[model samples]
Target chain A: MELQQLDRYAKALIKEAGRKIRHSLTYELVIESKADANDLVTNMDKEIEQFFIEHIRKDYVGHAILGEEGFGDDLLSLNGYVWMLDPIDGTMNFIHQQRNFAISLGIFKDGIGVFGYIYDVMNDELYSAQKGHGAYLNDEPIPVLESTTISKAIIGMNASWVVPNRHIENEGLIRLVKDVRGIRSYGSAALELAYVSTGRIDAYMSMRLSPWDVAGGVVIAEEVGAVATNLKGQPLKFLGQDTFIVARKSLHDSLLANYITLK
Target chain B: MELQQLDRYAKALIKEAGRKIRHSLTYELVIESKADANDLVTNMDKEIEQFFIEHIRKDYVGHAILGEEGFGDDLLSLNGYVWMLDPIDGTMNFIHQQRNFAISLGIFKDGIGVFGYIYDVMNDELYSAQKGHGAYLNDEPIPVLESTTISKAIIGMNASWVVPNRHIENEGLIRLVKDVRGIRSYGSAALELAYVSTGRIDAYMSMRLSPWDVAGGVVIAEEVGAVATNLKGQPLKFLGQDTFIVARKSLHDSLLANYITLK
Candidate 1:
């Protein structure tokens, strides 16, 4: 199928999935923890992933699927038409606040992303981008990122990163927080990247994130002239969890060179 | 006038002021720095404060007004009917993202808070409370805050507080951030307090805020059984800038005793 047709199909499927997730809020969610107590997963997360997987399998037989809830294929490589999905990006937010969470998805052809979508279910905002076609927010075209200095930049990051952590040294991150215009934490990697795409925030960083957490956001942000990389200034491999940072080109370079120091 | 009647009047006036502020967004804002570069004041802030002052003077004679833009009254004491207004809380957010800012207002009679209103212009959400009448959000009654332990709490605070700052030592605050489930910074004191009142967040803290910034939020939060006090566990004087913290009773007491340490 053509990329445009695929984009249309993905958007429609995602909206339908959002409706299901919204309806589930009325019922009691079966919650579980993975890795740690703070890392949560709900029944809705699994249900949403299964919903997308079933639809994709029937509609497009050859495509591969990699999803967060263990309902999709376990692929060793991204060498075909593959879908990377995080059914619910911020599970803790969904469980606590019932908001600030999203459904993030990205489609790649042989390891190159072609289409991305991040749907903020509570707000009904759909951020989408098709490679070389430009990014959009609910039918409106998103403008490209403008240049900003580090001192004037508003950064989105988890507060834990500024404290002592294993992934990166806290001293440099603390200094960066003091130097920036301001800092915000929304507890969702995908939503923060969507904010970067819209210029609501200049940059977003995380000590660790999986492929599904950032795949959709990376595409949307890159469409608007933003750069995405691991803390070491290397491109994402999309194979596992890694440190993440996405920002406008100038600010991204400045952060890597002066502010970020990996442990 | 009856407290309920005064509440209705305040609501109507606040909505009208919100309309004017929203309209001004289309025009180029006349911005000025106050105290420092980060402290900003815009034409809309002044215009909105003046708008409220004019209406209050005509409608409620002998009532004093304390507003952020300095267009209101200079009072020696809170002995009579008084209105505390912050025309635009989160001026930096307003100038940058054009959202997440709010118009905050509180009414007091003989030094006791009688009514409070916070109008989130962009989202059209109005959080209001009348003393002994309960709190509300857009006509829906807000429930009282539930108990949450420090380990399960999600806090709203500026990032600066965790770093080296004059108001509080960083060690205890850093430990608090690690112990909490999550942290968020919205950059708007009124909106953050509204979130706490609605139980969207467990607590909100600030290093320094003026009376106008916390007056409206304090009343609304207190209506829902949340405690509002300075960092040292004293009642807010509403006279000048001071450290602020608001939360459910248990969390508030625990935070003051265990987590907070002043410089």
Candidate 2:
């Protein structure tokens, strides 16, 4: 299918899924823990992922899906049309605050990102992008990211990275936090990436993240002159969990060279 | 005047000030730094503070004003009716993101808080409280905060406290981050307090904050069964800069007793 056609169909499906999720909030959620207590999953997450799968399977038969919930297909490689979906990113936020969570989706063809969407459900803000077509927040076209120094940049990052963690040295992140103008953490990786795309924050970094957590944001951010990569300044394979950092081109280079010390 | 009468007038004035601020975003902001490059103040900050002062001076003849900008009176004591105002609580967020900032105001009589208001200008969320009449978000009455254990609680705090800062020891904060379910930083103290009042985040802490930053939030949060105090668990005088923390009653005790260790 054409990219624009796919964009429209996917956006409708995502919005429908968002409506379901929002409606579910009126009742109690059936919550469960995944990896740990902090990593939460809800009935809505599974339901939304399943809803997307059913539609995608009926509409686009050959397209595979890699979703956070186990409702989608498992594949070794991204060789065909693959839809990466985090039905509800920031589940803890969804379960706790009922806001700040988003439905994230990224479409890839032959291992390259083709379309990205992150719908902030509660706020009704849709951030999306198609490959080579620029990025957008709702209907407004998002501007490209401009270069900013660390001292003048507002960084979006969780507090976990600066504590003792296995992925990277804590000392470097501590220094980076001090050097930056300010730091903010919204508890949603996809929304943080959208923020970076729109320059609400100059960059967003995480010590570890699954492909589904960042797939949509990476595509949208890259369209606006931002670079998405591992902490080692290498391109993401989008197959598994990896350290993530997305920022403007110059700031990304500076952060990788001076601030980030990988384990 | 009566508390209810003052509440009606203050809400109208705050909403009007918020309208002026919303309109100001269309034009370019004249930004300047205070204390350091990271500490920003814009022309709108001064203008809005002046606007509030002019209205208060004209309408309420004898109210003492303690405003962020120097346009208001500088009184040592909160002897009579005192207005503590932070026209733009998160100036950096206002200048950088065009969101997350708020107009914070607290009215005190004889050094006791009688009324508080925090207006999230862009989002149009107004959180207000009168001493005995309870707290509200817009027209809805906010429920009192329910207790949650540290293991299941989400915390609101800047990453600065976890790094090497002069105000507190970093190790305790690092452990606290690990102990909590999650940590979030919105770069706005007043808004964080509003979030606490609404149970959006269980608690918010800052190593150091001026009275105007916490004045509005403290009143709102306290009315919703949240406790506001310094890191050492002392009451805030709302007279000067001090360490600040606000949380559900039980959580506040646990954080002070087990997590937060002052330098």
Candidate 3:
């Protein structure tokens, strides 16, 4: 399928998945555990993932689906058209707050991202892209970002990165926090990436994030002149967890070169 | 001035202030500083405050305006019909992100809160209340909260409270974080308080918040049966900083008794 066709379908699938999630907004949702209860897995998460998989199978039978919930195709190679989906990207946010979650999807053909979508379901925002057609919020055509310094940039990141913890030195993250223009943590990676695409946040960083957690956002983010990379300044993997930073091109080198060190 | 009249004026003024902010958002805003270069302030903050002050001075000349940016009246007490305003609450969010900030205003009559208004300009959401009449989003009357258990609640808070460095033990907050259903940090006090009032968040707590930050939110929060209190489970001082938690009365009590300890 053409990239634009994929984007159209992905956008539709995202909105449909959003409506399903929104229907559960007032329900007594069934909450469960995936990694742990703290790492929430709600019924809505499974339902939405299943919704995407069901639709993609019927509509694009040739496309392969990879999802966080164990409901999609298992693959060794991205040799064909593959769709990575994280139906409820912020399940904890969804379970607890009933908001701040998104429906995320990315379509790659032969390992090249051709389309992406992240919908802030409660807010009714849909961030969509068709590769080189550039990213968009709803219908507005968003353009590539211009330059801005780190001191003038508002960063979206959790403070957990800065304090003494697992991924990096707490002091390093704390100092980084003090150096930025402002810091915000929404606890929703898809929404934060969408915000970066929309210029609401200049950059975002997390000590560790998975492929499904950021694939759609990664595709959307690059369309806006931002860089998403591991702490070691290598390209982000589309298959595993890594310490990642999705930052402005201007600040990426400095953040990688000066601050980040392996634990 | 009559308390009812003040309520009416505050509602109108807040909506108008939201209008000015909405208009200003169309342009690229210049963000600067108030505390350090890192902490942001903006022209929109000044403009929004000036807009409210100009209207209040014309309508109720003697009513003192207590505000964040030093643009309002110098006052010892909220003795008269005092208009407490954070022209743009979450000024950092406003200056940098442009989405999470809000116009927060509260009218107190002889030390009793007569009315409160928090207008989310970008979202066009207005949360308002007059004493005894009930709180509202847009114009629909909001009901006092239904009870929710700790395991099912979503708490709104900044990580500063959860970390061990400043005041509390990291483990205490982590315990709270783990006990509660989920965590969210939206970066705006007024908005979060409004969320509490609307039942979007079961609770909101923070260690460092000034009077201007929670004054408007406290009023709205109170009307919806979300108890607003200091860490000691007492009424918050209207002058200095304190640990603030606005939650369903039951949840608020449970949090103070079970989770929070200043030491």
Candidate 4:
């Protein structure tokens, strides 16, 4: 029931996991592709996920954990204290560049996000938020998202979103891309959300993201006054994959009304 | 002229400028938009360009300079040692994010890129190459790019290139985007090119890039056995802006034959 204590524990756990992951970088990595060749999953990802699950089970025996690596429970509902964990977001970047990845963790109680933490493992930046306590990047408090028009705003997006596919209509996404100030893709959804909270980029859009991918970011983003929702301007589903866009209030509205209509 | 001496001096000068730029981040920045709202230029960009010019003029007189900030010579020919400089390659990112920008410098000997350096200022990573010697990432030798199939390669590209634009046909670029393993946009052509040299990304495509943006990258890319050329499969003009695609040999040909044909 104490949100502050829960937030503190989450941050420490994520940081410790980050340290362990970084230390293991020198060891030989066994990487394998999942789903497809582009969708890579390394042993590190599973290892870190198991590490979190073990700690959570040991510390909070009653809590439920949902993780990307399949080392946690498959809860039919997030009724009680649930921890959504993405041990190594941007695993491809970790395998190729060894940078631009993070450990994302979000804690929810009774279906409400009470604490969130995104740790940029290589950069040593911890973007964390406790409900009603606001967001902080490391020790400094992050400012609320500022209102900027589409023409003046920079966005975080992947190139696949603009390509014609089964998802949204590429024509509409292309138009949005043309009108924005700039587009950046760091290959990590969690870091992209942290960037939105920090004003590094004005917004973040992706056609498909898992619950674990956006869990930590949504909380941090909401704390910084950014709206997190699906392309249809609906609240994201916490149980599965969905289309997501997070931005300032005005920009979010404009994007949903004008560009995201075709989807 | 000793090429070794020139290469050593260029590396030192770029690294020094990088240190100065990082130090100036704390000071007040005078920012301005050029050409359009998104096209940004800052006083620090001009300051760094001027610094390079002053040093080049003082140390090696009569050398031609082609710099992004226009503090260099207006030359009709690369008939001597020419220094191509992009003081800050990602000006918008520099003003907003204070990171992801770099000081790019390339020394050409009578129209040939002899030495190249791309210094990621915030990360303190220097990607450099001397002609016939090898490419390097901060003293570690960088190996030549390995041939990769289009289906298994990650491409670095901006969203603008995939949209219906005045330059390329959107259909072809869209298809290419779909076919690639992954796509990334870092907002800096210089950094993207450096990534190509380092095998961080397999290819980098741009509709319009000035000589300074890819000069340093071109040299380093060549040292790593990656091909750098305009979309038409022709060598890039060293004197002005042009469309560019830098990739591994096989992927470069594949893109030109299938995707870049419409340009």
Give each model's whole-structure lDDT.
Answer: 0.88, 0.89, 0.78, 0.86
Model 4: per-residue Cα lDDT over B108-153, one tens digit each: 9899998889999999999998889899999899977778799988
DockQ of every candidate:
0.63, 0.79, 0.37, 0.78
Error of 3 at B71 (Å): 3.0
DockQ of 1: 0.63
Give TM per candidate: 0.94, 0.95, 0.86, 0.93
Docking class of 3: acceptable
DockQ leaderboard ranking: 2, 4, 1, 3
Candidate 3 residue-wise lDDT at A40:
35
* Least accurate 10 contiguous residues by lDDT in model 3 chain A: A32-41
Candidate 4 structure quality by residue, lDDT tens digits, A76-98: 89899999999999988887777
Off by over 4 Å in 3: A23-41, B1-5, B27-41, B146-153, B160-181, B240-243, B251-263
- Which of candidates 1 and 2 is the stronger one according to TM-score? 2
Q: List the residue pairs that clash in candidate 4.
A: none
The list of candidate 2 runs beyond 4 A from truth reads A26-41, B27-41
User: CA RMSD for every model?
Assistant: 3.9, 3.6, 4.7, 3.4
Model 1 ranges with Cα > 4 A deviation: A26-41, B26-41
The alpha-carbon lDDT assigned to residue B10 of candidate 1 equals: 91
**Higher TM-score: candidate 2 or 3?**
2
